[model samples]
Each structure stands twice: as structure tokens, then as C-alpha cells.
Target: MVGQRQFDERRTLDRAREVFWLKGYGATSMQDLASASGVLRGSLYNAYRDKETLFLRVFDDYAEQFLADAAQALAQPVVDQALRAFFDFTITSMTTGVPTRGCLTTKTAIDTKADGERIRAALRDLLDKMERLVHERLSTGEARSRLAIPPAEAARVLITMTRGIVVMERVYQDPERLRATAAALIDALLTPVDPGRRSQTG
Candidate 1:
């Protein structure tokens, strides 16, 4: 019954995201969004038309923030450090929330209906954006032994491993093990120029 200006749109959308993230797109209902968002069901429908459309809005919001975080992680001075920061961010983000907490794009990609083309397209766009971010970082002239692979290929490998780590975090729920694996992956992939000593992030 509240007026549009009276309602907190961002707050409502954030709550809506929580519901979708927890219950998933298939299982969640508009009423669920209303309850979680503290907005009337009618108001929500009026604004977003349908759950698919509403989810698109919420997912886009999430993607913006997610990409911003990834960009920050990849902003470290050293390439290896930047890569480690990215993995650390991923591990902390995926593992901190409740048991069902995982990558939203990843979870949605797996769970959304086959006919959900719009959602699928959004997911693909987000993945491509992430790969581009990594590629930009990898293309930088950070010193010390870097990957033999091309920046584009290395970015793909990093993104693929990141998704795999998301799956691992969901299944294993072991943080230390995941960190160790990240370290090993980094060691295997990034070689030190000096060989004897490693270059630290500045």
C-alpha cells in the first residue's frame, strides 16, 4: 500500500536477491519476493511484470557488484598477486554464506529452465565480462615469470578454474584445502623470473 517513492527500491531488490539466491529461481514465487522485499506483491508485479523479468533486474544488479569486486581483486600491482587476490575473493565469497550459498550466475545457469533464454544470455554476458577483465590484467606488463600461454587463453583458464572452484567449494566445504589448491595452481602456472626467489606484490 506504500507509495513508490516511499518504498526503498534498492533495498527491496537486494532482499529479492536474497530470496532468489536462497530459494533459487525455480522454487521462488512472486509472493516470496514480496515478503522478502517488504513490498506489496501487486507493486512488485507492476514494476517488474513477471518473475523472469524481475530476476533479470536483480541478476544484473548482482553482476555489476560482482564485476566491480573482481576488478578490484585484479587491480593488484603484481599479476600473481592480482590472481591470488581474485581467487581469495572467490573463496571467501562462495564459502562464507549459508550452505546453499554459491555463485549466483553459476547456480542460475545450472538451475534455470532451458527456455530461459534471457537469463542464459545475461549469464553468458557476465562470464564474458569477467574473462575480459582477467584478460586485461593478464595483458599488462607485470614482471617476473608469467604464463607461456597467451593472455586470452590464460584468462579463459583462470575463469574456468574459478568456476570449478565454485563447484568445489559447494561440494567440499573445505576452505584450507581450496586455498592449498589455489596456491598449487598458481605455482604451476606462474613461474618466477629469478627462479630462486619469488617476487612479492608491491
Candidate 2:
């Protein structure tokens, strides 16, 4: 019985996540969650107390999955391969789904109508985790002389590019173009930096 309940909860959260992604926090309601998840409205209220609380739970679930995916992508022995894996995951997330729903965190960050401090806090926590994960990977790569860019600088560039990619994905909705852009950016960043040459400093 306990196992079944746990499975049901996860199923509900997955459906809830889809609804919330399709319709922002402001628009989604208990009825929306209930209908999408096929769970009783009273059951949802009893489990999560309120819509905000339920959304937070769903958001946390997303955070966990996102972090795990990042960690997996960065686990490759070669830095280049690791980065490619990460970007491939990112691009897949952006391009997948029926209509392609960009990114949850990026959309949440830009949502001006999204109320409450808790939502902002959740976004911050997830973003911080991502920043740390990317930075750690880059730092390790730099130490091993696998990357020419400084970890701190490269982390900032990569994170910023991630946000930009999210935006561009929505605007262009072209998987090929997005992949091409990411490839070009990776090539530029990975180019060897000659310190002795008096041309230009990176």
C-alpha cells in the first residue's frame, strides 16, 4: 500500500509539472492539476495543503532531476566530451516535447507575474546548484589542462549562454541552428590560449 501511494504521488506530480509548464503558475489552478493528474482534488489538498505548496514540491522534483542530469553529463573523462554531453542534454530539453517548452527555471526567472517569495527562493536554489555544478566541472577541466578558459570566467559565460539559448530556442524553434550555435561557441571557448604570443590576451 505504501509503495502504491508513493508511485501515485510521483505520477500526480509528473502530470502537475506538465500542466504547470504549459500554463504558468498564475494560470494553473487546483482543477487544472486535478484534471491533468487524474487525482482527486481533495487528495491533492490533503497532501500538499495548497496550490503553492504543491507547485513547490513539483518544482523541487524538477530540480532534483535537473541536477542529476547535469552531474551525469559532466561525468565523462574528457572535458570536451563532458561539455558536449551537457550541451546535448540542454538542447534536447529545449527541443523535446510536443511544442518544446524551453526551460522551467529560465521561464520562472523571467515570469514577472509569478508571486510569492518561496517561488523565487526555489529558483535561486536551483540556479545556485547549477552554477556550482558547472563551475566545479570547468575548474576540474582547467586544472587538468583540458580547457583553455578560466573556470570562473568560463562558468559565467556558459551559464549566460544557457539562458540565451533558452531564449533563442523559443524565438527560433530550430534545433539545427541551436546545435550549430552551441558547437561554434564550444570551439571558440576550447581554443588553446598562447600566453607568450603578444597578439591578444584572453
Candidate 3:
């Protein structure tokens, strides 16, 4: 059985995560956290010491779980299929829920500042991991002559495009359009060189 302290901490952390995810780091206040966490303000301070520190804890937990799930989903052997799944997951995860809070990293990229360097660094690390996984997937595609661009270049393009897509979805609130955009991106990345153009150039 979970000890009371451990259980209380977990509950507080999860509540804080939800509040931050929905409202963002800068906007979430101490009272907001205390209310959402169902802990008294005094007890909240005693447990977490301060709001920013509690936020960091919540952000770290969210990032860890998000990356783990993403890594598994992007691990499909086929590059095209894996990318399609990635886009689908990204869209659904960001758009389907109420309030439509986008990816936490994507939100932080827009909302955070120098004061939140820890969160920013963690997000950068996650993006780097994403790029590495995409590079590997593209490398496999390149081996089969399904990709013309260098895997490294394509990986960078894909990760950047994904970030853009996530941001755009928040403003547009159109899932179909975002899905199409992601699909086009994958198609462009995987499109082979035209044989006629190659022949003429050769």
C-alpha cells in the first residue's frame, strides 16, 4: 500500500500537472494549485516550499511520460507508417480534450522565458530525442532509396514542422487541416526523385 506521504505527494503533483497543462506555467497561481490539489495553502507550501518548484516537479513528470510514450510510438520499423502515427497521436492528444491545451513543450516554447530555463532545457532535450528517433527512421527509409534528402536534414525538418503544426493547431482549432498538413509533410519527405528529371540532369 502507498504511504500517506507518498500518496499525498503524488496527488499534489498530478493536480499541479493538470493545472499547469491547462493554464500554463506563468498563469497558474499558488491558490490555483492549492485548490486543484485539494491541499490547504499552508500545507501546500510546507510540502512544496514554493510554486515554481512545484511546477518544475509537475513539468518533469509530464515530460518523462510524454517522451516515453512518444518513443514507443515512433519506434515502428517503417518510417512512413511511424510518422503517420506520430502525427495522428500529436493531433489527437493536443486537440481532442476540452480546453484544447496543446503539447506542454509547445506551449512553453511560446509562453516561457529566461526565468524558466530548467523547463526550457528539459523541452530542448525532449526535442533532441525526437529528432534522433526521426533520424533513425529516416535512415531506414534512405537505405531503401525511399528518401532523397539526408536523414539528418530530414529529421530536422520534420521536428521543426511538427512544432509548427502543434502551434498552428492551437490557433486554428482544425484537426482535419492539421492532419492534412502532417500527411503532406510525410509525403514530401518520402517522395523519391523523379526518374525523368534525373535522366535529363544526368
Please, what are the lDDT tens digits per residue for candidate 2 over residues 1-202?
Answer: 4323533887899999998887778778999999999888877887788998998999999999989998899888666777778888888986778888778878777877666799999998987788788889887734346455777777778777878988989998997887788777777778654466427633
State the lDDT at 12 in candidate 1.
Answer: 88
Residue ranges of candidate 2 with Cα displaced over 4 Å: 1-7, 141-148, 192-202
Predicted candidate 3 versus true structure: per-residue lDDT over 120-165, tens digit per residue: 7877888998788778777773334777578899889988988998
Ranking by lDDT: 1, 2, 3
User: Total clashing residue pairs per candidate?
Assistant: 0, 0, 0
Query: Model 1: which residue pairs collide?
Result: none
* Model 3 ranges off by over 4 Å: 1-7, 112-114, 141-144, 192-202
TM-score of each: 0.89, 0.85, 0.84
What local lDDT does model 1 show for residue 191? 69
Q: What's the lDDT for all of these models? A: 0.83, 0.81, 0.78
Best by TM-score: 1
Against the true structure, candidate 3 reaches a TM-score of 0.84
- Model 1 / residue 89 / CA error / Å: 0.8
Candidate 1: lDDT of 72? Answer: 100
Which window of 10 residues has the lowest lDDT sum in candidate 1? 193-202
